[model samples]
Target: MLGSVTLLLERLGARTRHLAGSFVYAVGFGIEVARQLVLFLFGKRPAFRVLTLQILFTGVEALAIVAVLSLSLGAVIIIQGLSLLPQFGQAELTYTVLVVVITRELGPILTAFIVAARSGTAVATELGTMVVNREIEAYIATGVNPIAYLVVPRVIGVTVSVILLNVYFNVFGLAGAFFASRPTAGVALWEYVAQLGAVLQVRDLLGSALKSAVFGVIIALVSCHHGLLVEQASTEIPQQAIRAVSRCFVLLIVVNAGLTLVYYL
Candidate 1:
């Protein structure tokens, strides 16, 4: 009985320690990424080419998927809103529903999820493979700062890409809703645009941008952190990538809820 109790205590202690270490590492990673971003703003960072390529990979390459998903989502919302809202004589609420669902909520979150599932896992896998292959050490030996050259570009790329993709998603989503509404309710384009403009507040726009930015930052930091945590063996690369993607998804959800609550309050 005593032995079993001791074993349980040991396991709990180790788990706590692991959690504490992960928290600290995440904090430090965020700080480092922020510092690098400041440098980037001043044109003091190297690897502009790398940064551009990362943006293309994370943002441009993901555009089609974001567009398709957003279009479908918006069409569905508009169709349902048009069908159901008239029964309650709240057809005008369609604009409200569109603003709330597309602009304020689903847009940023879905964009983040796409970027996380795509680039986040890729970043983790790439970095983990680099670590396993000692490429990171090779950079250090050549007197290069891996954080600035490797991590900064990726961090910036992912964040910028996610933001841009979120904007595109919103644009496509609204367009989809417009097209879908024509068939369903025969709402005129100008009237639909007016309604959307009237229903969309500056505050909602600001909130949506803020949410996208935060989600981008979270995806970058979480992916990079997990990738860097890899130690020894190529077998661990896939595991780290999986962890990065999972952690990013969970963090995005939690942060989304918190931001939504704060925005309303």
Candidate 2:
């Protein structure tokens, strides 16, 4: 019995130490990325091509799917709320619910999930492949800072893409809700718009924007950090990509919940 207890304690200690080391490493990685981002912003020579390509891939290419999903989600909410809320004589509350769910909560979280599944995995896979090919080594040999040349652009691109996508999501979502309400609720477009405007506060928009920015940072940092963890084996590329996506999802949810809790508090 004593031996088993000692063994369990040893295992727990090892895991705790590993988690602590990982946390420290991630923090350092984030600091370095931030420093490089500042330099990239102010430096004479910026990698415009890379940054532009990243945005094109992460944001522009993702619009169709984001639009479809947001529209469907909003329509469903409007239909359900219109059907049920009027029974309780709380029909006017539908707009408030729409603003709260589509704008404040689901908008940012859903966009982050989409970006993570798409761009997060791509970033990790691309970086891991480059690492396996020793391109990172070549960059170092050429006196090019890999973090500045490669990682910084991606971080910025993904962060910008996420924020833009979140806005896009909100717009389409609210628009879909308005249209869906027209047939069922028989409300004019202007009336629906007015109702939404009445319930939607400036703070709701600010909270949403804040959530998007924070989620973007989290996704980029986690993806890049895992991507760089790849070693010589090509097989590790997919493994790292999977890790990046999974970690991004978990972090996004945790951070979103924390932010929502803060907003309520």
Candidate 3:
């Protein structure tokens, strides 16, 4: 029994190391991408078209989903707080709970989750379609870097989108929570907003941005990787896209959990 336990520990260690390595590689990719972006800004390599398209696809497309989620989550959290706070004789703590959860964590994480589900799946499907059509190979044959041409735009797209969406969500969520908690939670709507001024730290927002940024990276990178790995089979396109999104979901949750640990623990 001890031997089996030891073997399991070893396997877990290896898996951890592998994931850590993948994360580092992803970080490196982001760095390289940033460098290229700087060059693009200076007209060294003009890619305004790609960047504009990215903004449209990533930022605009995600607006409705983020708004709906933020409002629903804000309403739900307020309801939960109302239901539970009286039991502890601390109904006013609703303000603390709402600001902490919505502003610091859930706003960003939820935005990323929704973006990953929508944009991430779309990226995989598009790239997979390109692969099935032999376009990636043709691009490579023409000396175009596939990752630069295909992956970087979506990466920048999701990153920008997730960040913008988080901001929007936080704003709307606060409004929703204020409205939702008015009848209960033992605090006036204005009082809750004012209390948030004291409790919501800058670090909370920074942590949220970092978490969402990492999530954006995972969504684009994993999806693109799986998409590019698709062979000639058309059936493999859907399979790889599904696998990519699933892997991205797991990665996003793991990363979010790690960030939450850093903040709370």
Candidate 4:
């Protein structure tokens, strides 16, 4: 029993060290990507082909689900908020509540969930397959940066997609509230909108956008890191994918709390 316990502890220590090394490598990958992006500042530079693939994965594929969810969420919020407002005789507060809920909290959280379901799994599985086939080893031999190729494009794509989708979510969700609202209250479209503008500041939008970007980076980095760790066995790919998702969810919640504290506290 003593020998077995010692061996288990040794394994745990090795795994912790491996994770620490992976994080350092991922950070280095992020810095190098920033340097490469600087070269694209020149208008004449050719566009990145990887970005096109990422757009397909992040934007085009995610649009339908985002649209459906945004519309439904907006209608539900208006109905619920309006229903409760009469308790306090302040129905106009619906606009403020809707804007705050959808813009700041729901938008980033929902988009992060969507990204994890769609792009996150794909990233892990792809990189895992590369490892299984020894393609990653070939890249290492050729001096290719898998992190730059796999992670950077995903980070850029998911961040852009989440922000764009959040904008659309606010637009469509706010609009849907009018149609789904009850007949008696019959709040004017402009009235709710005016109330929203009165309450919500530009800072709210920027803050939400930043949250989405953080989600993108965390998911991309975590997914790619696990994928790169895939072992020789085929079973390891799915295991890594699951680990990546679990890590992303935990990190997202922790990050959201930290950001909220920074802003509100």
Candidate 5:
């Protein structure tokens, strides 16, 4: 019994140490990426072509799905709220609910989830493949700063993509709700617009934008960190990709919840 307990404690300690080391390494990687981003902004010219392609792939390619999901969610919210809130004589509160749900909460989080699932996994798998194929080594041999040329572009692209997608989400979601209400609730466009304008505060917009930006940074950093973790075999690529997605999802949720709490407090 004593030996078993000792063995368990040893394993736990090893796991704790590994996690601590990984956290420290990730922080270092993020700092390097930030430094490279500043240098690129200052005309160090990391890789404009890579950054453009990354934005194209992660942002532009993702519009259709984001539009569809946001539209559906908004329509459902409007329909349900119109049907239910009227019974309690609180129908006017629907606009507040819409802004709260779509703008301040679900908009940022759902957008983050979509980006993490789509772009995060892709970034990890692509980088892992490069590592496995020794392309990263080739870049190093050629005196190319792989972090600057390869990673920084992706970080900026993913972050910008997530923020833009959240904006798209808010637009489509509110517009869908308005149109959906026309047939069911018979709410005129002007009245709906006025009600939303009244209830939607500047803080709400700032909060949503802040959440999107933070979630974007989290997704990009976690994805890149896991991607570069791939060491040897091709088999490790998918595993690292899976790790990236899982970590991004978890971090997004935790960070979103933390931000929401702070917003309320």
Candidate 6:
């Protein structure tokens, strides 16, 4: 029994150390990507071209799903808001609810979730496969900086895509909610617009942009870090991909909560 207890404690300690090291590695990865991004901004046409392709893959390719989700969520929120709030003689608060839920909160979080589900896994799997295939080493032998040439473009693309998709999500969501509300509540479009305009603040938009940007940064770093950890075997690719998605989901949620709290405070 004592032996078993000691063994369990050792395993726990190992896991804790691994977790701490991974966190530190992710932070360093983020910093390196940021440094490369600064360079990409200064006059890197090759990086720009790569960034465009990544944007096409991660952003434009993701529009349909984001649109469908936005429309569905907006309709549901509209239906629920109209159904429940009017009974309390608080029909006017519907716009406020929309502003708070769709604009300030769900828009960015949902966009990040979608990007993570779609692009994050793709990044990890692609990179892990490359690593397993020794393609990363080949790049190094060719004197190419894999982090700058490969990873930075992806990081920039995903960050931009997430932020843009968050904007798109909010726009589609608000518009869908307005149209959906019309059939049931008979609310005037102009009135809904006016109410939203009145209730919405600049800080709400800034907070959302900040949240999405930070979430994008986290997702990219986690995915790339896990992908690069593939030291042996092609079988590890899927495992790394899964780790990337799970870590992104957890980190995004935690960061979202922290940012939301800070916004309110």
Model 2 has an lDDT value of: 0.92
Candidate RMSDs in order: 1.2, 1.9, 5.4, 2.8, 1.4, 1.8
- Report lDDT (Cα) of residue 86, candidate 6: 88
Residues 1-265 of candidate 4 have per-residue lDDT tens digits of 9999999999999999998987788787668756655544443333357767777778778888888898889899988888898689987788788878888888888888888878788888888999999987887788866555555666677677767777777777776776677354676768666777898889989988888888877877778777877979889999999988888889889998898788787
| Model 2, C-alpha of 75: deviation from truth (Å) | 0.5
Residue 255 in candidate 4, Cα distance off native in Å: 0.7
TM-score to native of every candidate shown: 0.96, 0.94, 0.81, 0.86, 0.95, 0.93
Ranking by lDDT: 5, 2, 1, 6, 3, 4
How accurate locally, in lDDT, is each candidate?
0.91, 0.92, 0.79, 0.78, 0.92, 0.89
Give residue 113's error in model 5 in angstroms: 0.3
Ranking by TM-score: 1, 5, 2, 6, 4, 3
Which portions of model 5 miss their true places by more than 4 Å?
Answer: 1-6
Error of 2 at 105 (Å): 0.4
Q: What is the lDDT of residue 38 in candidate 2?
A: 91
Off by over 4 Å in 3: 1-45, 183-189
For every model shown, the clashing-pair count is 0, 0, 0, 0, 0, 0
Superposition TM-score, candidate 6 onto the true structure: 0.93
Location of the lowest summed lDDT over 10 successive residues in candidate 5: 37-46
Winning candidate number (TM-score): 1
**lDDT (Cα, tens digit) per residue for candidate 1, span 1-265:** 9999999999999999999998888788778777877887787757788889999999999999999999999999999999999889998899899989999999999999999999999999989989999999999999987888888888888888988998899899999999999988898999999999999998887889899999998988888888988999888988999999999999999999999999888
Model 5 lDDT per residue over 1-265, tens place: 9999999999999999999998899889989999988988887675989989988998889888999999999999999998899899998999889999999999999999999999999999999999999999999999999999999888888888988999999999999999899998788999999999999999998999999999988988888888999998989999999999998999889999899999999
Which residue pairs of candidate 2 clash? none
Candidate 6 lDDT over 156-182, as tens digits, reads 899999999999999899888988988
Question: Comparing candidate 1 with candidate 5, which one achieves the higher TM-score?
Answer: 1
